[model samples]
Target: MANTRSSLKRARQNVKRNTRNKIIRSNTKSTVRNIVDLVKTKAQDALDPQKIYSAYLL
Candidate 1:
């Protein structure tokens, strides 16, 4: 429990940052998983730089 005003505000900020980080982490993991699946299913596209770049960027 946060008793002080500053501590309470800090706690709230931590919660918000945690949720934002989780969202970013989830997106990154899913993007990697998608890239792996693409490589396994289509060897040709995997070699193409543009395809991989697009996958990670978008």
Candidate 2:
């Protein structure tokens, strides 16, 4: 092939990885935050944790 790939390839890989990690991290954070909010506000988020867990599955 031509001299392998360009530096952009590595950069793109990093971008993809960062995006994936960011999304997952955000999800986990929001999950925990939802739990915290429920406890702090003393209100039911979904009547049970099962609802949150099921939502995370998607």
Candidate 3:
């Protein structure tokens, strides 16, 4: 559907960025969910400030 070469290139870039963003969003959601679950369960590691800070850093 892209009529010009530049548009086709942009379309390809959009697809690549969408895929990458989806992966990052999924990972962030998963990490947040895990942290919430750990807090609810009162897990010892979750109580550590360093570990919790490091989780988001990763």
TM-score of each: 0.67, 0.52, 0.66
Model 3 error, position 55 (Å)? 28
Q: Put down candidate 2 lDDT per residue, 1-58, tens digits, no spaces.
A: 6445786788889999999999999999999999998796655656568877998899
- In angstroms, the error of model 1 at 18 is 0.7
Model 1 alpha-carbon miss at residue 23, Å = 0.7
Candidates arranged by lDDT, highest first: 1, 3, 2
The lDDT per prediction is 0.92, 0.84, 0.91
Q: Candidate 1 on 5-56: residue-level lDDT in tens?
A: 9998999999999999999999999999999988886888778899999999
* Candidate 1: worst-modelled 10 consecutive residues by lDDT: 38-47
Residue 58 local lDDT, model 3 = 100
Q: After superposition, how far is residue 53 of candidate 2 from its true place, in Å?
A: 32
Of 2 and 3, the candidate ahead on TM-score is 3
What's the ranking of the predictions by TM-score, best on top? Answer: 1, 3, 2
